[model samples]
Target: MECAAVSAPVSSHPPPSQINTSPEGKKPPEHLRRIIGEPPGPIVALLTRGVWALLTALSPAARDALARFVGNLAYTLGIRRKVALDNLAQAMPEKSEAERRAIARGAYITMARVVVESLPAGDRMTPDWDKQGIEGEEAWAALKAHVATGKGVLLATAHFGNWELVGQMLIRFGVPLNALVRPLKGALNTRIAENRLGAGAGLIYPKGAIQEITDAVNRGESAFMLLDQALPAKAAVFVPFFGRLASTTPAMAVAAERTGAPVFVVMGVRPPGPGARFRLEVEGPIPAPKPGEFADPITEHTARVTAALERAIRRHPEQWLWLHRRWKVQPPAALVTAPSPGLTSGPAPESAPKV
Candidate 1:
């Protein structure tokens, strides 16, 4: 199968001592490494493929039932459950403990739906995408107009809802989307990449293709990136996310500041249904950074993006990909303080909601 051309693995080949390493820093024990650090064995890879195919074949009702079962199962298995629960608690302190737990487990269910049903390569974009796929009419009209301007679009979407499908649905609808993706290390993730590429979406490797991607956007080519994942300490700045400081990449903000391109936030949420349906949403644009907002343009812009994301997550509490360790990198105690004296902290000014 054809795969999107990604940059070479970010790091040079590791020494033998660090052969099987988790991206999370430390190495897991020998057996655990096989699950997290090392690539899956052939048998496991084969099983994964079989499952993917089987899931596609199942009826929508069956798939829905399985989605719930798998989501709860993952939580019960504690596959990053603690981190998810912690994030939910910290982000939504006002909610009851039981509500947080339900949201946490429901996130897994969303994951299961994503894994089983995302569109594959060569899936044609049809009128159905522009019709049933959209959730907000004005948001959709704004997005179409933004694309028409040939002024690059940089969409900062989280690992929320059916994010992979967001790209697929857009691609299928004849939108040119080149996503900044970090290809996974193992067999399962690699195959997943292959399917995404097949769906007619372009891939921009995150490690070294910033300039190329920026140029593409400037030329009217749209790009998407996940804004709710961890980044290296040296690269990301801590921004308030879900009430705590999360190390955020200033890429979207930086790009918007540099090119004067419009930044849009989007999501493909799975509405409650027993059919294959997704509400592809185009949220309002994040205003370009300005000098008066704060001492640093990057922080001001990124914090606005983070707040926008928080608002989206709040709208549908269970649709987010909660298992991700979004707040893994905390800010230094020195940097964790209230906003500077005169600068009020909040979301960037949204333009009048015009189509």
Candidate 2:
């Protein structure tokens, strides 16, 4: 029998199907199981606080530079550089060879700076998002209008730019938002969580988060989702990204489908400045399913979001995270992969001009 288009998301609650099974039955992958729980507890909270304190001690310049250092170091060590470069090549195949390479280098620098800037700090800065010069102001304006209706809004995002900072920005504006995030293992995760929470954003794990988000929306709360990861085991469908099939999460679609809540594809892009300035762009009351469409709107919703993400990355290649294995699972040979002229494979060829 076929499962629901968007199968009940892999929540933390044990399924009845598991009750009759023996140990021999398939176990969830370690990564899925690891994040299948709630946010860190008090001990975890304490650790997070300490980490944030350490990060907070650093000056803004130091923090930004440190992130740049890590990004370069990661490239040197070949961490996700292939995937980053590959993804970049796909996005801007028309650029000159040098231009493509420059974008890659800028991307690395941006990735590293973004990471460092996300570190836990004693206090989080509240930047006026309007100053960032978002291109699509009408979309965001419409979303804000929904706030008056008292219906909670869902801002679906991806691993594109400084996403966590998006949550921080909303919180600073006093917009109550709960960000759905996977827990990082050990001390590092704890610290980041603490800093984020301190910055006025709430965190929920995928396991039990559905219920929480649903209830919040029912009671008029806004939520944020980052839907740009490849979860091979869980129920995910392929969607075109950079002309390649990338595993897109159906959670945003499911959430919208179930709640009848209007969905907006919002993302944060880094601005050109001395320190970290960001532009938050919100797009659409993402068209939802009508009376009788059989296929999931998630695939469509994901497609739209992916297109937006690609555009954003193209505009600011340096600000996106190139280290994440976004296209880890390659599709059939028919799909595109080879590097086109001007768009060489892998990290920037060392002397390319930034886009």
Candidate with the greatest lDDT versus the true structure:
1
Q: Give the per-residue lDDT of model 2 (tens digit) for 1-355.
A: 0000101211122233422121123221222223222456778868766756777788776777777777667677777667767766776688776776666666677766655666745433333333565546566666667755767788877655667666656544334566677656555555456555555455666676667678767755677887667767356756666666777677777777778787777777766654666667666766654655534456665665556556556566666665567778765454345322221112321122223
Give the lDDT of residue 209 in candidate 1: 55
Per-model TM against the reference: 0.79, 0.74
The per-model lDDT (C-alpha) reads: 0.63, 0.59
Where does model 2 exceed 4 Å of error?
Answer: 1-54, 126-130, 330-355
Write candidate 1's Cα lDDT for 96-202 as tens digits: 99999999888888887766555222332222333454545555566667766765577778877777767655554435666676545666566566555555456
Write down the worst ten-residue block by lDDT for model 2.
1-10
> Residue 48 error for model 2, in Å?
9.4
Q: Score candidate 1 by TM-score against the native.
A: 0.79
**What does the lDDT read for residue 316 in candidate 2?**
68
